[model samples]
Target: MTGLAIAFLILSITIVWGGLVASILFLRSRPEPAEYPPGGVDDHREDIGPAERDT
Candidate 1:
């Protein structure tokens, strides 16, 4: 392949790989999922105000 084609292919692969890595890191940095007990209620976080609950 020509130099331009090879460069373009490499750049495309790099961009896609970078986006995947960024997505994984972003998701990993987020808070963990809520743990719900068998009672059917979620263990809410302190950040959630009382008004927000059961609404």
Candidate 2:
């Protein structure tokens, strides 16, 4: 019974730590959100203004 309890404790700890590590890695890999102002442009473009372009 003692051996079984030790094994169960180790397994549960491993699972919990593994999930925590995976969640950290997953969230680290995602891009952050950038909200637009009210009634602002709802587009996803990297267009530079013609005059603002470096000659």
Candidate 3:
């Protein structure tokens, strides 16, 4: 491949792999929250919001 083509290929590879590595390291250091706030998917609170008023 031409020198310019090779350079662009390396640059693209570095960007993709670098981002992957950074994310892995970040998640490893600070994992996802085990417990989320209330009003999530399983929340059944009636006062959380208004009923089907269509406002």
In order of appearance, the predictions have TM-scores of 0.55, 0.53, 0.62
Task: Report the lDDT tens digits of candidate 1 across residue range 11-50.
Answer: 9999999999999998899756566565345655656555
Looking at candidate 1, the ten consecutive residues that score lowest on lDDT are 37-46
Better of 1 and 3 by lDDT: 3
Number of residue pairs clashing in candidate 1, backbone atoms closer than 3 angstroms, sequence gap of 3 or more or interchain: 0
**Alpha-carbon runs more than 4 Å astray in model 2:** 33-55
Model 2 Cα lDDT, one tens digit per residue, 1-55: 7999999999999999999999999888875547777545665554644355566
Order the candidates by lDDT, highest first — what do you get?
Answer: 3, 1, 2
RMSD versus native structure for model 3: 3.9
Clashing pairs in 2: none
Task: List candidate 1 stretches off by more than 4 Å.
Answer: 31-55
**How many backbone clashes does every candidate have?**
0, 0, 0
Please give the lDDT score at residue 25 for candidate 3. Answer: 98
Could you say which candidate leads in TM-score?
3
